[model samples]
Target: MIDTKELIDSGDLELYVCGALPANRAQEIAQISKQHPEVLEEIISIENAYQRLAAGLAPDHNDETYAKLEAIIGAKNKVVKSPSSWSPYIGWAAAGLLLIASGYFYNANNETNEEIVQIEQQKEFLETENIEIESINSQYASTLQVLSDPETVKVNLAGQAGFESSNAVAFYNNEKNVTYIDIQGLPEVPENMVYQLWSLTLDPLTPTSLGTLPIEKESYNELLRIDNAYDTQAFGITLEEAGGADAPTLERLYTLGVIDKG
Candidate 1:
């Protein structure tokens, strides 16, 4: 079976949606999409995202202004002849001057249009970049607030045997019933596997799954928020199959931590 996660992360789906992939490659993607429903879903998502962005960024055009531009570009210059003895020379001279002026203005207008297009493109690019920066900054600010809050409980998960260097932190908010796990110290997860968080109860050694970590570039080292209302006394992270297992795999456990009651 093809690794759908790997294919999605490879960015081929985005290229396919943008119609940037070559014919053969696009055909291959189409064939694969039939075999893998997830790939087809990703392609649709990319197309929807692009459509939303285009709708938000598209400039409005005025019909009157458009018509004026068409008129200016399509109108032909005419030089009327004077009904006098020197009509021939005067008409020729006037026509020559008119032609020269028209050519100059036409070239200047085209240059101006090109400049306007370039400026608009640059402005759009900068706006997109600014939005991304603001989003990242907002996330960082939120995470910092949670970390600094007095009521938030911070648990440190130490690496397990054979994975002594790996570590992760969980910020638990009792009031909000939310837990944000910071996996910055953890190594990159293997493509075929995923990292799953578990909330543990010490009395009977019960474990509750908290879903699998997302396998995206932006998700790496980022604070992942999980909804947790469980009365967890301990937390553990384990490496599991792509879709995650119903229960924690004991042997594949990477990190474990016990909440301090004192």
Candidate 2:
């Protein structure tokens, strides 16, 4: 779409509205006029100018013609006055009905304008929201590019212990390190329950619980984001009882994966 402000500033729009342009340009102007009310208003002003010029060029009528018109109008007024005197009640009734209809039409027009304004406001709000969503999507794309770099270490976590079949993958970066968990394979956590991740160091079998995954049952992209991952060893997933787990439950170990040394 062309910029409206630029189109308006171009003198071609004025020439098009004046009907001085070629057929193609005229068609373009007509399409623009249909799309933009301001363009249509400009066209109307140009048409009114043409009308006034044509009227000014017309032949003039003399004072005798004006006198004849006045005489005819005066005669008609007297004839109308006689009937009007006899039908004062009818005239009053018609006037009352006209007032009621005018009021009704005025109110309807006001309501229609209000509805149009509300719709325009809603459209503007939706457009702004779409822009914000697009911006967030772009940022996520950049984050994915960084996470999927060839140097980033990949880990496949497989379900263990109680939940034996569920699986997930985590991509971790050491330099500019971060962890992203693609948990689509994991089943939905029950109400008030969450999946807790653990970062493990193998020598003494100690683990750092890296917080819970917020369940998004309806999201199209079900991957969860975990940040600040300058990890010492392995990755593990456990079913935490509500909110999050303060410590990993070895009995509820849903998945585990050793980080690739390479």
Candidate 2: deviation at residue 158, Å?
1.1
Worst 10-residue lDDT window, candidate 2: 77-86
lDDT of each residue in 25-127, candidate 1, tens digit only: 9977876786578999998899999999999997986667755775788833212222333334445778776776676677667666767776777799999
Stretches of candidate 1 exceeding 4 Å from the true structure: 1-92
**In terms of lDDT, which candidate is strongest?**
1
The C-alpha stretches of model 2 lying farther than 4 A from their native spots are 1-108
Compute the lDDT of residue 98 as modeled in candidate 1: 72
Question: In candidate 1, which residue pairs get closer than 3 Å at backbone N, Cα or C atoms, i.e. clash?
Answer: none
Task: Report the Cα lDDT for residue 2, model 1.
Answer: 68
TM-scores for every candidate against the unseen true structure: 0.63, 0.54
Where does the lowest 10-residue lDDT sum fall in candidate 1?
Answer: 76-85
Local error of candidate 2 at residue 201 (angstroms)? 2.0
Q: What TM-score should be assigned to candidate 1?
A: 0.63
